[model samples]
Target: MTIGKRLFNYALIYKKTIIFALLMLMVAVAADLAGPFIAKRMIDQHILGIDSYPWYETDEGENAVLYQDTWYKREDHFSVDDVKGKEVRVLQVGRDYVFVDQPVTTPEGERTYEDGTLTITRSNEEMSYPAVELTNDELLSFYMPEVDDLFKLILVYFALLVVASIFTYGQKFFLETSANRIIKKMRNDVFTHIQKLPIKYFDSLPAGKIVSRITNDTETIKELFVTVLATFVTSIIYITGIYIALFLLDVKLALICLVLVPILVVWIKFYRKYASKYNHIIRSRLSDINAMINESIQGMTIIQAFRRKSETKEEFEEINKDYFDNQNKLLRLNSLTSHNLVGVLRNIAFVALIWYFGGQSLTANSAISLGVLYAFVDYLNRLFQPITGLVNQLANLEQALVSSERVFELLDKDGTEVCEDKMPRYKGNVTFDKVSFGYKEGETVLHDISFEAKEGDTIALVGHTGSGKSSVMNLLSRFYDTKEGKILIDGQDINTIPVQMLRQHMAIVLQDPFLFTGTIASNVSLNDPMITREQVEKALQDVGADRLLKNLQNGYDEKVIEKGSTLSTGQRQLISFARALAFDPAVLILDEATANVDTETEKIIQDGLEVLKKGRTTFIIAHRLSTIKNANQILVLDRGRIVEQGNHDDLMQMRGKYYQMYQLQQGKQSSLAG
Candidate 1:
């Protein structure tokens, strides 16, 4: 599946919260849109009052008022006694006007007509459908009610602002909560998938690169949910709201504003082209850098011992410089194309609106209202605000896309091993029948080989480095499947056995023992609940590692640092032996398990090995000729082929390759003693 579709599935899991937040976001946007519309209402209705005049007098020729160069037609007159010391109400009825005395303050006004001067006075009597005379104070009284309405509209605008603020915060809170939950599940899924991958997969990929996918890459993906998701969603809603408001205010301006759609689409397409390319390089380089750093840290001791620190530093610096240069390139691209360019477009849009409206306003009959102009500018500003935000996040969006792609790439690997439950256990009668294999195809590391060991036998393999001793162990343990022939245990092919079940009956102690950061007992038992404290203690005692822990304050509970760095090599090997013993597998393999120990430590380990090897089928791969002298069978390998196989004494009597190697080692010991 594509990353987009997979992310959509993850999003569906939290659809309830998302849908609620989106609704709240729309409400908030509506509240925001109300502000400019309210301002437009104030401009056109309350402040300007362009169509609100209603005080034309038409009763008498002398009493008629002239306003805006048009004289009022005389209609009727009323008595002064009827409205004395009271407010006058003027209401227009068809071509004439009606006067209702308001009984507060008497109002009268004077105006000069084209041919005559007229005086308007207030009346106490109610007159139906007639013009009346009124003073300047009466004209002021006509607008008095509008002042109260304007104040109320201002209060409403502020109330909407407050509402928008609250709903906006609510939507943000919901989105953030959902984003955090989604990414948490994603990280877990990635880590779980890593465990199922084949062992060969790890051989090809660096540990740090895998770590980057689970840790750093997943972290980068978080921004996609937290910021980018919210930003893009709100931007869409905000732009739509602005356009709706624009159309309501003035259809002409709104239709012209449609030009932004194609322009914005083109801009995004152009920017994403370069951004995706640069972002892919940046992400790839970052993974490489992380892999390098992890390798350097892990091998710091070897690097320092070999005096290759300068060379390592130089190599790392080259990678770091590449990462830095690509970042700058992306930066330059963002600076040139996105946010600032969006600002320029916004200004151009504003100029276009003003120029178009200014031309419309030049004609009297077709004048664009000031309210429509104010509201249009406000809506345009609001519409471009989200556009600017989206443009600013273009680089972040690209980075997130690249990071997600890398994460999913790891998840999409084909080498997931499924070890089923209820597979049969092995009886440890192992056999290799014409087996041949390679790390890579068609390059055989082990040729046609055959071997057999009975259930209770202890077989030994002696070989120089690169002589296929470890390859045999690797094949027998199913670390890699056989490319030719078959490996069998208890008369059945090992390939048919579930990997976990096969591994459950076998244990290996490597030359370099690895220890996790934990207490000594925890390391021995590996936190297995099935292995009780008694079993752990017994295992340690059986392997003779109890002596190493006896001096520590905590004994079995003594803390071990990462990779057991605080422990001596012999101490770590002893722990590894104890771990193998605690599991008590049916088959045991030791690949140079005691090679790193001193002579005294080796003797102790050798004695422990005797006790631990009881009743289990054991395979020993040793470089030291003295380690496997009493084996029931010894196989001497050379160049991926077994040149000699027999009991140790038989090989010695025959004076074969094993005998020559043993004699060489004896001579070295004698020379050292001399």
Candidate 2:
């Protein structure tokens, strides 16, 4: 599915809230659009109604103005049953009201009153009528009948305004609430999906980049939901309301305004053409900057120690500058397209209105009413507001699209499902049959490797760097699946088992132990429900972590910060060892677990290793040959192949690569001692 459709699918999760918000929005728009029509009625029917001719003399007292000695009422105020006496006209000619006893043939012409006579002239034609001028007091009395009705209309308009305000608030509240909820669900899914992704997927991507996708990119998407979505929906509805109002007022002008819809569509297409490119670059650079910052923070010790601070600053500044430049480009595009485009289109609309209305006025009897003209102008002005809003939100729309694409791209990656099903513990019998693998295609990291370890056996793998020692452990742990051959555990192919369930009965302590930010006990137990407090304590005691951790005031409860930076290397390693032992795995793999510690700590860990390996098959990947001398079997790897395999005495008797490596390491120790 397209990114837009994917985003819409997410919105569908909360469709009810969005639908209700849209309904509220429509009501609010309807209420607000009623204002201009009410004003038209007020202006035409009440305020300007006095100029309407042919007042009838009526006997009814109500709405009847006593003019001179006669009771006169405007035709609109005359009741159906009222008795009529004589016809008269009250007309406004050049801001002065005149009382004409008899009606003129036509009221469209210019009028001049002189010497008790009213002369109407149109195109060299003239007619005259006997007239009388009324004072302000008399005119006020004539308008008294409309005062009550006008006040009522004003109240109605105010009530409509109040209704509009209330519904507007409702729409905004619901829309923002839905927006926050959508973003919350999306963030949770992204984080959850990250767990399902394979370790190799993270191998080529930086932690910082992934962090940016989850944090910065998702934040941009939230704005798309919160601000962009609301603005676009509201603006579209408002524009539609305005168009409908315009059509009610004048069809020809409304049809002319239809041109704006196409213009706006084309404008968005053009804007996105450039904006998308800039936004893609901007987002990519932002991820790069995040990655670089993360790497710098992680390696700050080396950076500062080597005095590469200036170089790192320059590198960061370069990426930051690129990001800034692209942002400025997007800003320029928005500035040129948003309000500026709306202003030009608004000017065009007004110019067209002037030309159309001006042409109408040129006809012999063509004249638009004041009320109709006022409402048209009002509706026209209102139309541009939504257009401006929509145009302004285009940048955010494009940005959100780019961010969504990134997020969805991550979500689309193939990931393993975390299975929670229980599998009965099997005997610790592992066998690798002609196994060969590589992280990438056509780049073999491990050659046809075969090995076997029976139950209760200790198998040690010793090799130089880049000699596939850790790769063998990785294959055993199923971090990466091998395509060439099969790995069996307890006579069953490891690939047939679920990764999570397979790992449930296995444990590994890495060369550089990683600890989370928690108490030392929690790190050992990993907050697993199966491992009780007693098991955690026993594991710690068995791993000799108590001896190293006892100096701290909290002892087993001592706080460990990120990556166990607050504790010593030996302390972190002991915690890792305790963690492995706490699980009591059927197969235990220790990958150079003692490579970074001092002799005393290694000796303490050696004792722990003896206990950890009992009655369980163990695979040890060690760089120090002395550490694995007591193993039942030792496999010495060269390149991607195991060159020699035997007991320590047998390897020494064979005088092969293992013997040479062991002699070299022993010679180095002897020289250091001398």
In terms of TM-score, the best-performing candidate is 2
Best by lDDT: 2
Candidate 2 per-residue lDDT over residues 1-674, each given as its tens digit: 99999999989999999999999999999999999999998998888888754787777588888888888888877668877778888887778788888766686667888888888877788988888987899888888989999999999999999999999999999998999899999999999999999889899999999999999999999999999999999999999999999998889989999999999999999999999999999999999999999999999999999999999999999999999999999998988888889989999999999998887765548767778888999998999998998999999999999999999999999998889898988798999999999988899988989888999899999888999999898888888999799999999999999999999899999989999999999999899998999999999998888899899998899888889998888888989999999998999999999999999999988988888898789999988999888898999888889889988999999999888998999999999999
lDDT of each: 0.81, 0.91
Tell me which residue pairs clash in candidate 2: none
Which TM-score value belongs to model 2?
Answer: 0.97
Question: For each candidate, what TM-score against the reference?
Answer: 0.86, 0.97
Per-residue lDDT for 219-326 in model 1, tens only? Answer: 888888889999999999999899888888778878888788788889888988998998898888888998999999999899999999999999999988998999
Q: Flag regions of model 1 displaced more than 4 Å.
A: 50-143, 147-152, 418-425
| Candidate 2: RMSD to truth | 1.7
